[model samples]
Target: MKKSFTLAEVLITLGIIGVVAAMTLPSLIGNYKKIETVTMLKKAYSEISQALKMAEVDNEFMEEWNFTAFENPDERVHHFFDYYLKPYIGTLKVCEPLEVGCMSDKIQHLDGINERPHAAGKMSFITKSGYSVLFWIHGDGTGGHFIIDTNGPHRQPNTYGKDIFRFILTFKNSSNVYADTAGYSKGLKAFGAVDGVTREELTGGNVSHAGLKPNYGCKSGLMGLYCAALIIYDNWEMRNDYPR
Candidate 1:
């Protein structure tokens, strides 16, 4: 006679399955999040790069954009965004510098202790594709910094080096003898690389490299400014040792 399993046996099998799923589900979810982060980061990078190239075509090179022409920092940032970037990047909503709503008021460092206040005079907006973008002109007005939240600011893990990443717009020619020797160009570059941090150092090959600042790098316990460069260097894939 053919017989189905008894209730006791069926319950035992179900219990084992539940136990296995409980053990594996978290890991699976974490990996999926990692993949999503990487994909969004790459997409944001590509979109910004293409926007810069297109802006250059119409507005001339970034270096010639005359950021200092406007005395007020807010005005300068607005001019830069309106005349150079907005046309190409296409913002869905624009928020005045450091205004609430568009960006988080305080961005947490990767280490989770230090927090960065959204400084005054820094413009922020949401991109057409849903990323939150913030722009800050350098102190000297020579270049600007672009920080993006790949999953938008409303999402969790607003911590740096996670959903948040940084890029630099270098308008001036490189003064770094090392960067020149390394054949790095001046334009848009990932944050650490703009400071002359090499790809190897960014990817954690040599975390102590002089160009790497304390509290900054792709590794855990640091600020995570170089995490974007690390991912880019690794062909847009988060490495196995990538800090969660």
Candidate 2:
């Protein structure tokens, strides 16, 4: 007779399968998180880059890039949002509760909006040391999986600086091109290199924003294509240097 497999046999098979899944599941999950982070970074950088380029057309690109001390912080911010950024970035506002992962305020206007705890509604930029451009996109950190500040202020990796707002490209009103301010700002920093050009000679310079790996240094392994794309695009500098 065609004998059927016993329940014990089936149970044992399932147990074996479960064990294999349990072992591999964590690895798969980790990889997924890494990919998600990288993808987010890439998209953020791309959006900011495009917006900045577009904004530059109508507004005069600032000669000097500095966010050290603003003579008129409020006005400078207003101008940036209304004149410089509004046209390019739709529904953009000074991220109220900047620390909060989500952009709670939907009001298009920046007036009377509650500011960040430390920032106090003051605006900043994200860019290279010499270059000047502010790229602070608003969004919540998705469970440590996504943080704009760490990636490229607002999502685009430009340069390094203390002031989160002072990006690689300078705003028209800002002062001289501030150098090495990528890490000063309170918001997340870029998780990759700057300018899509990473060279050994430039590795440890005032301009470098290196050691920006995704997954927050939790793990080091092969990242998915999407994640790599994000890093490559957002962290232009690192992407440039990598062999792959």
C-alpha TM-scores of all predictions: 0.88, 0.50
lDDT of 1 at 210: 41
In Å, residue 57's CA in model 1 sits off its true spot by 0.9
TM-score of 1: 0.88
Candidate 2 yields a Cα-based lDDT of 0.35
lDDT (10s digit) by residue, model 2, range 1-244:
9999999999999999999999999978856644554454445556655765676666554332233343444544454456545567544234432333222111111112222322333343333311222223222111011123334333332112111111232233211223322322222223332334343312222333432323212112222112222344444323423322
Model 1 ranges with Cα > 4 A deviation: 139-141, 176-184, 194-200, 203-211
Q: What TM-score does structure 2 among the candidates reach?
A: 0.50
What is the RMSD, in Å, between candidate 1 and the native fold over all Cα? Answer: 3.0
